[model samples]
Target chain A: MKRVGIKDVAREAGVSPTTVSLVLNGQSARIPDTTRDRVRRVATEIGYAPNSVARSLRTQRTHTIALISDRIATTPFAVEMVQAAQDVAREHGYLLLLVNTDGDHDVEREAVDALLSRQVDGMVYACMWSQVVDVPAGLPAGTVFLDGRPAGGGFPAVMPDDRAGAMAAVQELVDQGHTRIAYIDAGEEPVPIASRLRHEGYLEVLRRAGIEPDPSLRVEASITTAAGGVAAAGELLDRPPAQRPTAIFCFNDRVAMGAYRAARHRGLEIPTDLSVVGYDDQQFIAAELDPPLTTVALPHYEMGRWAMQVRLGVLAAPTENDGVHLMPCPLIRRESVAPPPAQHPAPAGDGE
Target chain B: MKRVGIKDVAREAGVSPTTVSLVLNGQSARIPDTTRDRVRRVATEIGYAPNSVARSLRTQRTHTIALISDRIATTPFAVEMVQAAQDVAREHGYLLLLVNTDGDHDVEREAVDALLSRQVDGMVYACMWSQVVDVPAGLPAGTVFLDGRPAGGGFPAVMPDDRAGAMAAVQELVDQGHTRIAYIDAGEEPVPIASRLRHEGYLEVLRRAGIEPDPSLRVEASITTAAGGVAAAGELLDRPPAQRPTAIFCFNDRVAMGAYRAARHRGLEIPTDLSVVGYDDQQFIAAELDPPLTTVALPHYEMGRWAMQVRLGVLAAPTENDGVHLMPCPLIRRESVAPPPAQHPAPAGDGE
Candidate 1:
């Protein structure tokens, strides 16, 4: 059967094409009620799909995609992710519409509704460090999840391979001839899948190396801000020098920055005094620090591009669906980490 | 005349209230031709207004406002402005939708169109820095400009008192007992009204003090990034140590940070070796730097809140409207500036 067009609906309803266009586009506020009803009824009966793509061809798409994050402006990683996302979006004839929801469910609901109302061809829902938030029912058709896994089913999502990324960070610290390594976890619990996976990866690496994970060496903070990282660092540094871990692995760049500041405040030099490793290599933070940070680079730009493509309905659901796309998180070796301090003698624990 | 309700329209059209709603809301894709036409004609004959506010009362207004910036992720001042805007928007039960246009006119057009399509109750158009960009014609009613004066001038706008702000920076430097103070202006030329006012402010203070405004001391950089500031610093520093200005006043915070980096790289101590003042006191950059920066603070949050309230029709337009709301820019004193080094004697320059 031939596809129905606006002309056909207009002819059937005995309304002008302009009337149909106005009513169909939801600009019916300016139109008289009688005409709007007639046009809509005829369009519906004739099975008109509104042909948004066809409409877009005539009027160039704003070449912009909406990026809705829980609270992006304050989070450094989120800010960088948005920047990378905008870069990628611009490369593909699109701009980024970034909305900060402040993690309010009502706000999130309103944001989604507003984006839909704007007729965003696609959407990128980037949560700030994932937590299980209910995806509102009845979202605009083409939407993708970013930095988060779809909660109740399959949806196109882009997130780091947290398990592998965490393992790599831990493995690198182990390889640098450091046995006593501590983990500074910055996030609330029943941690996000990404966070949990990373934590598990750290444990897996420790287990494989025949080293027991010590509870005392693991520190958890509520927020992933630099201040939280500083607090975590304080907790780690309060232990006796001999009992302190030789190296530290931070949750992300911000936490690592905090750790750097904390170490300095305590009069300890980096690398020589205490080695540090961070994740999410944010350029500004990394470049500005006294000794540049060593970190794991999550493919933020690539993920953003892929998220848009997925929302545009270009990708089919993964056949071997694990419900997660685990992208590689590569390590960036910088001056922050080095061989453990030579002066301190090994603790009096059995080699076995 | 009584306000015509959906029921009244339905009664006139001899159709169900749902049918009138489908037509009025433009959900016409599901209705039939004959009935749609009859319903529309009857509704129009009765002159029905949908009363969006009443609809919102039944279903809460999205309560989301879009705070759109040309590009913010890379511009530190823009980022601070967005954060402030978000804070105020949230306080007003409104979420901020941030769009990065990358300073592209086409992108700005598209972003505005998208925001309008979303049915945002109000909008805040914030450009990164100030420039002469045409506001798209026929903006959906209820939009306000921020940090920029509208080109064709219909909307309410909020911008800093650039002349006053600039004068404050220069006056502060002068009062610290430095006759050889220089200015590094970074922005587009013909200069934004804000920059022009600032330059005027600088000259105003200089002329009042009987100090000849040296053309050599005023340098304009392409953009206000740290790199731009560093290059400007290099130009100033290339002069003989005795010839260099005692103090430098930067166009914005990023440029100041760059100057700070350059001075530190050249083994000069802040204030003691060289005094500096910046604009738009960005929090993160200011707090993290070694000697926290002293700069002018733009009232970003108040401006944003006021901008939104104007667009929301909550505030009446001022009678003596200058098309711009000039907020006071206050000095935030920190560790970055002090009296010039006592070792070097003050330079005797040629009169203008």
Candidate 2:
């Protein structure tokens, strides 16, 4: 069978090939509605598949955006961001091309060159975790960053408001009438921006509540995983009844899971005996805990949507001085928080 | 400055535009190496970016493939498959375009039409979970399925060997001196192929060991999540000490997590009082458990690579008669498995 081309559609529709092209390429606003309909109907009747590749060469608009990320598609973290970007892009008749670099610079360069070779209209550079990243060279002029900011601070970035999220988490604990609060900070030297901002939020809340931050109550987890949570929370939980914190704020949901285990090991019932709050509201881990978990949501989906909008010009592009968009991180209330216990129990045997 | 084109490179290299196009498009095999290197050097020196869209229109080879998946890119499950497919495609000098349909049929049709319009050389149709899916209409011929088989059974498919994976999980328990074992199956009504195959593996292993399959031991989880596992495993663990199984083979990692909690509530330490094995070594949930879970890994990454290889003709395409490729699922040994206890303790208070 012979493939139908634009010339065939033009001959059948009794119009110039350029006219047929304009009607099919969605640039037919000036063309009468009847002519547009006739061209489309004839093309459909003759089985003519409009070739975007050919149209793109003439118009310099492929209507395709490339999303290059370090590990968003492969890792379990922040997958919603990709979905949200795809959703917005689809609505605008633009296809999204995904490329995961696996955190390799060479792979990233290759991916950028490939997208540029195809003349993608725009690019979305995303990161799995919220951090400052060095924007690779050769990216197009209007590249938008998701969940991260450029180290040189020129590109537009959409990131979760970590400090505000932390304040919300701690405020919930304070609202529950808990004064003795402990914080399990994550990461070591050169801590991530999220960790630093979250810690600052925690202290700000304590200060506003007229409560002095206790040195012993502030502990650092070796990492942000559940294992780290257990060790950090265990130290605070092992303290005498009078000295132990009544509530704990963890770095992330994984660490909160550790707090759950630590509390379980010490025979402490959540909320009743101790209250806990976590950050990043990670899927499965947060909602699947025994008492469920009260935590801060990272706004990944919203960030994705915002970045796509910026890239596509649906939203105004951020200026050079105001390029970073700090999306709000809302508090998700679950069953993990309540008023402090009436009285504390005596110290129990230390359990690993 | 004006944009550089093939004409500029041709003029600079003292060659015709045809020669410039042939060399830059990787079709310089018939040309002398000296001319080919000279053309490429001139093209690079002048910063002439090859317009692939224009080249594709003339040659009908876009060097691009589309991966249209039902939730694979958005969801955490089977994400490695996308990564693997991208890696293989990138190695072959092909860019992979990703479109997630979000399980909507209309959305899928639009995605397919969009890809076809763009003239992708081929497509990989992927599903987040292994199952028989109805191939959406309008997908071009030679489309390959990953982690799923077409319901009509014509397209080539790459899927995990769920039956063999279950066998490995159960065989491990049998080798570890566990006589009495229980299974927590998932999903109801239209049970997924994985559930049925895994059950068969369990029964087959038990029969070969000459152990009678206990009807009470084979229970069903209302859902595959941790909450469902708690309810299902709680029922089994609530049985009399003499009647309880020493090991529990959960449907997946989430269910295994529930079994852990159920055992803790019953004062049964993992592996010491009860042994547990899970399937789908899901990221975070499997490795981040209290004692890392022993589970079977779904061959998602391998399946992705295989499907891409078939699509790109790197491997022999599956014939209609042998279109389904079953990749093996290997057992990841962790701390969750051990020998059964020496003696059963007397029935203690029933714990939820």
User: All candidates: CA RMSD in angstroms?
Assistant: 10.8, 5.2
Q: Candidate 2: misplaced stretches above 4 Å?
A: A13-15, A22-38, A189-191, A344-352, B22-39, B189-191, B344-352
Candidate 1 lDDT over residue span B30-79, tens digit each = 89888888888887788665543335434535465776677665554456
Q: For candidate 1, please provide the TM-score of chain A on its own.
A: 0.71
Q: Which ten residues in a row have the lowest lDDT in candidate 1 chain B?
A: B51-60
Best-performing candidate as measured by lDDT: 2
lDDT digits (tens) for residues B1-352 of candidate 2: 7668899999999999999988976898898999999999998898888778888998999999999988843357677888889889989999889888977999998888889889999999999887888889888888999988898887889888888999999999999988899999996834488899999999999999988999899999998888999999999999988789999999999999999989988889998889999999988789899899999998788899999999999998767556998899999999999988878543767776
Task: Tell how far residue A149 is off in model 1, in angstroms.
Answer: 4.8
- Candidate-wise lDDT, in order: 0.73, 0.89
TM-score of chain A of each: 0.71, 0.92
lDDT by residue for model 2 over A1-352, one digit each (tens)?
A: 8678999999999999999989987999899999999999999999888788988998899999999999854457577888889889999999988898988999999889889989999999999888888888798787999988888887888989999999999999999989999999986834488888998999999999999989788899898788999999999999888789999999989889999989998899997889999998888789999899999998888999999999999998777556998899999999999999878443666676
